[model samples]
Target: MSRAGRLGVGIIGAGKVGPVIGAALAGAGHALTGITAGVDEERVQAILPGIPVLDALEVVRRSELVVVAVPRDELPGLVTGLAEVGAWQPGQLVLHTDASFGTGVLAPAAASGAIPLAVHPAIAFTGTSMDLRQLSNAYAAVTAPAAVLPIAQALAVELGCEPVVIAESDRLAYAEAIAISTEFSRSIVAQAAELLRGAGVPHPGSYLSALVHSTVDHALSQAGSAGAGPPAEALEG
Candidate 1:
């Protein structure tokens, strides 16, 4: 596809990540051809009101850019299944949002002439419009071959993310680090909220939300200034 043109995009999953990212790409002028969601139809529709909801094969056949946002474990099977059915088209762009596996997992589709890309946004998604604003400050870990790296980066930028190239060999370790930090942060916030509620504070979670946001923003700013150095304290348990 030409750099100036918008591709016809289809989403293979309508879970938390898919609809939001599909919406972001739609906002970037891409035509949202269809989306597939087995259980979260209502939530998906709420996130992508006018987009058509179709089956996975139909989605793949109709789109120039197919985004596979299923869970990490299901990704490889889905890609291979699609390839086996000859769903992937020549010069098609295939992207996945899973942080654990890079484009290597999309080898089945790539062998069929699809351009595989792994572009993961390093932010928690709420499957709501609120997530859109979060995209501006979020960083996306992008893994693609050198020849198509610019295309991945461009898509990330269009979605309001700063794209960082992640080596395929380092993808799993990178995902683990993100999981450790984000999951631990959530646990800490939940514990704090529980303690506040025990002390007779109503809406403890609501009260703690702003403080957590501010603290995280400050920490990220500090980390950026420190040039990606390891944190003084380990977050992992």
Candidate 2:
């Protein structure tokens, strides 16, 4: 599907993930009708004005698509509660950002007979409005039933992201990989910044960022070589 007829999405949590991504999706042509919130009033009000703010159940009832972007520990209960409230309509798309598991975590909603899909962006979030722009090119992992693979993939494309299909069983592994990647980046940057400080650099963040860019490039290049041969040789290259 092209960008023109983007789907209307209802976000059930306006905390860190929902409001930001919903705003970005709205910018990308998807109709973001309403957002649900339980966070700081001043914060939520500042970010999402004019748009209808509803209770979580009301959000699930009003929209064709439901996005559960709440905290990990809270997801199961929130989803179960939504199911209990008879909120999901059949064929309504229920999506989540929980990467640690695939659509399997959505079994409850699915049993409610809703079309369950899970979308997870690979980029780290800063929980800022500016971060909305970054969604334009970030990567997303998608898991959905085969019948509506296109819809799920199209949702990722709607955000201007390349969609990677994560197998139902592999979602946890992919999430763990993201955690590793982030921690490794932090550790390496920390060490590099310390070395730069030793060198009396006035501003180390820029240098550290550049170094990270180069390192990531080199690693990706090495990875592209199926015949990269040996770890030592690839590193030396």
Highest-scoring model, lDDT: 1
Judged by TM-score, which candidate is best?
1
For model 1, name the residue pairs that clash: none
- Those runs of model 2 whose alpha carbons end farther than 4 Å from true positions after fitting are 2-6, 38-49, 194-202, 227-237
For model 1, the local distance difference test gives 0.89
Model 1: residues with Cα > 4 Å off, grouped in runs: 1-3, 229-237
Model 1 scores a TM of 0.90
- Candidate 2 C-alpha error for residue 127, in Å: 2.9
lDDT of 1 by residue, 52-167 (tens): 98999999999999999998889999999989999999899999999999899999999999999999988899888889999988888888998998899888888788888888
